[model samples]
Target: MDELGIIEQGVDWRTRLGQDIRDCMINDILFSLQTKLQSTSTTLIDLQKVAARIEERIHTIASDYGDYLRRICLTRGDLDSYDVLLNDCQRQQASIRSSILLHQENKQGDQIVQAKRNTMGTSSSSVLSNQVALNDHKEHSHPYEKDMISKLPNDLVQHIMSFLSMREAVRTSVLSHWWVNQWTFLKSIQLNIYWFHMDREKFSSFLDKLLLSRVQADAPMDTFELKSFAIDRANCWINHAIKHNAKVLKFAEYGKWEPFYLDPNLVELSSRYLETLELTNVALDATIFSQLANSCPALQNMLLTDCLLEVEEISSSSLKNLDIIDCYILKDLSICTPSLVSLCIKNERTDNSSFRNSYLIFATVIIIDASSVSSMELLAMDRQFTFVEKDGGEPMFNNLRNLSLGLWCINNMFSPLRRFVRHSPMLRMVTLRISPLDWKSHLTKEHQEMLISIRDRRGLILYIDWY
Candidate 1:
């Protein structure tokens, strides 16, 4: 053999020996990692068992404490303190359980990564080849794993898509062929212009296409929500939603100067199946309330936030829940909803001094007929607003059970608060929330006397919250 051939053979032999040594080292490291992982898994299982036992013990202790509380006569404050402690214990148990679950997931993930590393190794060439082989194996053997969501029933998938916003749901069409038309069948559609990363023209065009597709599909909308900054085509979209028999309608326009106003014709069309109406930063016509009362028999809940209300009365027979938050009332508004079980009116605008001043100046009085209202919250935390009867007669609340009032509203020598407590025959609880600023103000002897008088009433609980 030639000298060059002999040298080449020696070099090849050395290279093979080096590769064998490296492989042996890698095998030893893998074996050590596997042993440590098995030990860690065992420890985790033991820790999980301990956590379960601790949780069981916590439940037992809570039950024992609850029984002790029931056996002994305790003040409302003491009972509340005990309740808070019990809640903290329950929260701790939840935290421990969540930690255990997270540890289990992390352990499983680490095992998966270790197994992959053992199979692929540290060599770049081998890692790439193994990855390709793994991909091919997954594609051939576990084809369903690539598109597991598509395996679900059409109705189930559409129901899941309903939770996503209209833009997000539409984007899912790009995921797979099965998801292409799933968004069209969504019962709930929420369109927020801010979510769409497009210019006004594109957004409008996209919205038009989306609504047209739904219309063509003849899909019935259970809920339709539109949030935008004063879109010109809002009325058209609302008309489409109503045409599709939307049960819940939410329209919020962010333009403070030029708020979106509901079309009277669209309102009438929506009244047939409209169970809930939520309007934010919208301007209402003077006769909007009357129209809703007369036309919308299915309307059960209505929420108005930062809206411009140019109405005198809000009379709804079918309305069950009403929330009026920081709305601009042009005149004194009277609420006479016979079927209203819950009514919450909150005006807390400390940040916007200008809006607060305007709201206080323009929105003067709110007359409420709480004859059928079981739960009522009248909170004007930033300012004091008095609620009185229009006829100057004693206000009677026949079904007023739970009343929550802000300190500003009830701090006027407790005059309004006293009237409510006196007239509410079925009153069970009154929750008074005091702001930090108001907490500094000392209560007068008259205020204390009225508070004692109200608290001394039988079957009625007065809870004060200094927040």
Candidate 2:
């Protein structure tokens, strides 16, 4: 009961402390794995379930021995084995995350390639007919004997019909008299000339009938989309859409400048509730902007492509996202939207000088007053146009996080680019897409000047496209 007893007590205390340290380390590892698994998008549910199982196994292994010293002694090698297992799990997670990110990048690359093609309505009639056929299949695929779809409440049935194209939804009338008037209460109206076998008159007549059928219905038109090469009687169709209180209006047509000049009054009429307006290949006047500013209280997104904006300034209070692509007749594109968050300006001209004459070239000065804009992209075919900053000071792009410029801009406009870099304090990434030209063009004196300027600028993360 002297020196030997005291030494034995000290040994017991040390073993207990070591056991406690091992348990705490194991717990930390489990917690870290769980947190990481939760943050991941792919395999989250599966990984969480696996982690729970592993945690349970660890708990069982650790709790088997009541005495901490005894447990530490019994599973010392097992603890080392657990450490190896955890390391393997982390490595597996990293591999899975890498694979997922690679897959997403590949998917995004495919989408970018598809977007570059930009061909609209290839085989319009054929595609319309095929879509109708698919709808017909969906209509008949479910066996009525076991299906409760028909018995669903009117609102739910209406929701189901909303998923189908207007033609397919109307075809349901032939299925049962109970569904005869259901399509009349549709919240969306989408009309395509090809739906009537490319017969313009028939298409026009069908749309008139459909609109007339819904005239007395209590339903409001939430979305109205029209896709056609050109519609002779577009005025009547547009009037009906506005009268029905369309909240989202999209017209994709080829008006060819001379034939189509949209009525500015139309914008005024739908301004109360119109949240999104997208027009392609239509002509517009300066009055359109004034109408939008004065009337469109709820408008959030506006997209103009291959259209003529007879106005210099596009000022709106409610607009959040504005995308102008291939629009012309602008002396000064002065955007003054306070709530605007994103602005994208795409090519108004092409690389081929011969065909470039046909495109509507933008004005020289682009005056942007949207202080809230965080993401700005200027993707132009030609390296032209000047960005007019306020008061000639360090331009106030206070929250700008992403800036994308055409490669031609980087090659030619060194002063403006430098100003932009100085202005954007929070700039995170700069993406440069090269123009479709020979690499030899980038080796010119102008390119040398730009390279020198870029090198002088510090704290820029440049991302150049190799493809």
> Each model's C-alpha lDDT?
0.60, 0.59
Model 1, TM vs. native: 0.62
Which stretches in model 2 have alpha-carbon errors above 4 Å? Answer: 1-152, 255-259, 265-270, 348-362, 391-394, 411-413, 436-439, 442-456
Specify the highest-lDDT model's number: 1
Top TM-score prediction, candidate number: 2
- Evaluate residue 389 in candidate 1 and report its C-alpha lDDT on the 0 to 100 scale: 55
Per-residue lDDT tens digits for candidate 1, residues 320-365, read 9999897766566777787889998887554443222332333444
Residue 33's lDDT within candidate 1 is: 28
Model 2 C-alpha lDDT per residue in residues 48-111, reported as the tens digit of each score: 3333333333333332323333433323323232222224544665685576555556665664
Clashes of each: 0, 0
After superposing all C-alphas onto the true structure, candidate 2 shows an RMSD in angstroms of 28.8
Q: Tell me the alpha-carbon RMSD of every candidate.
A: 26.7, 28.8
